[model samples]
Target: MRSDTLDERSAVKLLLWLLLFVLCWPLALLALLLWPVVWLLSLPFRLIGISVEAVFALLRAVLFLPARLLGHKDA
Candidate 1:
């Protein structure tokens, strides 16, 4: 016997995807910002475009630097 509504399954899938996205988001942001994407994207920041995802992007910049520097220059 199986029991699960389509809506309930969709909700569970959404939650799983959100968790996966969050776990993988730093890597995504790192790729975006380390490349030309941030410059292209951030241009709007000074003007009239800001978003929650942008906030996450900013946080990724801070988090990535220290580990990156340490890797480059060993203490």
Candidate 2:
């Protein structure tokens, strides 16, 4: 009110609202408006993550079997 310009005050107010919308509003509407699109886009990433996990699990099992057979480890 003293010296700040109207544009500056309006910009500050807009920034506050923008922050709130980005932080809280999205959480509430998650999977509501863009469920199908987001899920579709993420399908590849999800599959890759799952495949990597599966490969790691298989390797762990293979390594454990050999070590156990040689009496080098308990598990």
Cα TM-score per model: 0.29, 0.48
Clashes of each: 0, 0
What is the Cα-based lDDT of residue 72 in candidate 1? 58
Global CA lDDT computed for model 1: 0.72
Q: Candidate 2 — which residues are off by over 4 angstroms?
A: 1-31, 70-75
Q: What is the lDDT, from 0 to 100, of the residue 41 in candidate 2?
A: 97
Q: How much lDDT does each candidate structure score? A: 0.72, 0.80
Question: TM-score of predicted model 1?
Answer: 0.29
Q: Over the stretch 1-75, how does candidate 2's per-residue lDDT look in tens digits?
A: 555687789899778767766889875366356768888999999999999999999999897897778878553
Model 1, residue pairs in steric clash: none
* Weakest ten-residue segment in model 1 by summed lDDT: 26-35
